[model samples]
Target: MRYGIVGTGMMGGEHIRNIRLLDDVSITAIADPVESSLDWAAQSLGDQQPARFRSAEELAEKGEVDAVIVASPNFTHRAVLEPLFDRGLAILCEKPLATTIADADWIVERAARNPAPFWTGMEYRYMPPVARFIADVHGGRIGALKMLSMREHRFPFLVKVGDWNRFSRNSGGTMVEKCCHFFDLMRLIVGAEAERVYCSGGIDVNHLDERYDGETPDILDNSYTVVDFANGVRAMLDLCMFADGAEHQEEIAAVGDAARLDVLVPPGDLVFSPRVGFGAPKQVVREHVAVDDMAMEAGSHHGATFYQHAAFARAVRGEGPVEVTAEDGRRAVLIGAAAEISAREKRAVEMRELDTTG
Candidate 1:
């Protein structure tokens, strides 16, 4: 399969690297306004050099590609996708669909009409351990899950091409920008839509001393968000951007009537605790999920990006279904936008208040 990548930044580089690991595939074209970024993609390409363009429009119009990966900045998602959608090429746009509901909805509308596959790049679901945990929960091992929680304690956001992520306007706030993965997982595991959202977050630590053109960064460094699902399942997220010292960068737990299940990254272990008597012998089981060495090295997402690319390739080849759709992307943004509103207003926000139908 021939591929074209838009926005050759850090993530664009990651995608190029993983695509190289797949069979019968090559990045035949790449587009990015930044000459340095284009050079980076060229260096990553090594022996094979694909056609290069300065914009998505030129790539769609002139480049020879059967698929495109939109790894552009958050705020530019909608605009970058317009020409690509017009071309009807298979696309794997990265997470958080858009910075706002309106733009996300727009992408959803266009994606539904496009003939080619439209996949949302949500790699969290494909992480081996997390994938196994999700299957166990869905297979009734958790016994009708009642509550779910996710925690991401990691370093602050890294430097982007132009510091575009330092502001809420560009990166969609921390809730929509970084936390959308957890929210998307919540929806997937709960099997229900969110009814309300409450979040308490702020830029307490990271980027406080940083400035761009005399303007301070306004993105959140930590937050505690609670979501109520329509199926009566409650989910919570604890995010701390200043906790890089923590052992695990991401952790997720699911509790039901029978027992509680937990998954931890880094070591990639799945822990299961079945309910015993009040004082009976305690029993706990831990299983390690291993990822391929090359896959693990392809990206920083614990081998998720590699697996996700494989699945996307299947859908592109008509061998499997599109696991993550544009609607899935929009739903994640809906809940995230609600969280942003709740954190700013210091109150809970109802999902219906967002009017996602637009």
Candidate 2:
């Protein structure tokens, strides 16, 4: 399948590398406003260099591509996607499909009615350990899930895309920008739909002089959220973007009837243990099973990206299941939107009542 890439940023570059690894896929075209980014990709790919364009609309209009990967800025998603949707081309869009619920709903509704496939770039679902853990949980190894906890703490925004990510209007704040992964993962593990959400956060640190359309930054850098699912499951999400020393930390813990499971992303460890209770005059039983070294090699941080692309390619070729679907993407965005509303209103936001069916 021929693939076209829009937005030559960090995630876009990762997609390029991943596309290179697939035998059936070729990146036919790339579009970015930045000349240097387009030039850099052309130089790196050599004979496989893609046709570079100045805008996503140009690529969608003129490029001979079967699929388009939208890795552009958060706010530009709808603009880029609307044109492609008209072409009836398959799309792999980055997470938080859009900055607002209305835009997300539009994309979801359009894709559902369109003939071509629409996939979201929620790559965390394709992670090796996460995939395995989900399988085990579904297979009843962990029994009925009860609670979930996820944390993501990374260093300050020193990277190039860091500036754009600091604003809520641009990046959808910390909850949508960063914690969407956790929210989606929580949904995947619990096998439930979030019924309500409550969040508390603010721009406590990382006070960079970043502005969106000349407005002061409104995105939160630190956040904590509680999500209640319809299946009687609960999830807590903790996110911080200004950790001084920590390089990166991501983990998800789920408590079940038979065992407790913890998935640590950095180390790629899925530790399982039987539930044990200690009493004043009783011995403690130790039952822990650790599945370590489950992630791809250290340099291959784009494993899930590669896997997701391959899955989409196969699906286009009339193959097996696609990793993440448009409906899944819509739910992720809905959860994030609910969290944002909860944070703003200082109250729990109900999920199902929201007009997301569009």
Candidate 3:
């Protein structure tokens, strides 16, 4: 597979590194407005430098690549994807799909109508731990599903990726820009559509003028959301990038009637607690059963990126379902957008109100 990448920023660079590791796929072209970014990518990939284009249009018209990976800013996703769709090229787009519901809907509609495969960069779905957790839940290791709680905490944005992400108009706030990953995870764990969402957030940190230029930072720096799923499952997400000294922390805990499963981190430690009952005033019996010892392996964020790219490549070859479909991406955006609306309005917002049909 010959792959072309748009936007050579952090995510784009990660994609380049991962694609280089794959056996059959080659990054044939790269598109970025910044000359420095293109030069850096070309230099990093040894002698087999990818063709560089100044814009998505130029790349789509001249690159003649088999697949295009859109890792540009949030607002540029639709613009990059439209040309790729017209050219009948498979695509692997970064999360959040687009900054707005209408734009996201357009991409979803295109994917439904087009023959070329479209995959979203919700790479967490490929993590071995997460995958195993999903399987266990589906296998009924945990009784009836109850709730999901996840927290993604980290330091403030440090990497300089243009000025688009600092403002909500460009990135659709931090919730939509960053929390889409958590929202997507919640959806996967709940296995149900989000019925309602209530949120609260504020830009209490990272209030630097350089970050937002003269424009006010409308994007929240800290956010909390409660999502109600249609299957009587509730999910709570806490996303805060302003936490001091915290590199990153991610955990997903699922509560069930008989057993509880918790994925501690990227390595995804699964702890199962079977329900135990004791007689009140009579007698107590203890059962000695050895706990399952599944060795957890640390995961490379870059490896997850490579895994996602490989899945996209395989899907293009008509192998299997996309790791993360276009509809999945749209749902993530819808959840995040609804959370933002809820935060702004100080009330719970129905997810259906933000759905495509609405």
In lDDT terms, which candidate is top? 1
Q: Predict model 3's lDDT versus the native.
A: 0.80
Tell me how many residue pairs clash in candidate 1. 0
Per-residue CA lDDT of model 1 for 1-358, tens digit only, reads 9999999999999999999999999899999999999999999899999999999999999999999999999999998999999999999999889999999989999999999999999999999999999999999997989999999999999999999999999989999999999999999999999999999998798988998999999998999999999999999999999998999999999999999999999889999999997999979999999999999999999999999999999999999999999999999999999999999999999998996473
Which sequence of candidate numbers ranks them by TM-score, best first? 1, 3, 2
Model 1 residue pairs with clashes: none
Model 3 root mean square deviation, Cα atoms: 4.5
Off by over 4 Å in 2: 158-162, 208-215, 279-302, 356-358
How many clashes does the backbone of model 3 have?
A: 0
lDDT tens digits, residues 249-290, model 2?
A: 776777888778777666667777776565434332333223
Clashes of each: 0, 0, 0
Q: lDDT score of model 2?
A: 0.78
Q: Candidate 2 has what TM-score?
A: 0.90
Residue 32, model 1: lDDT of: 95
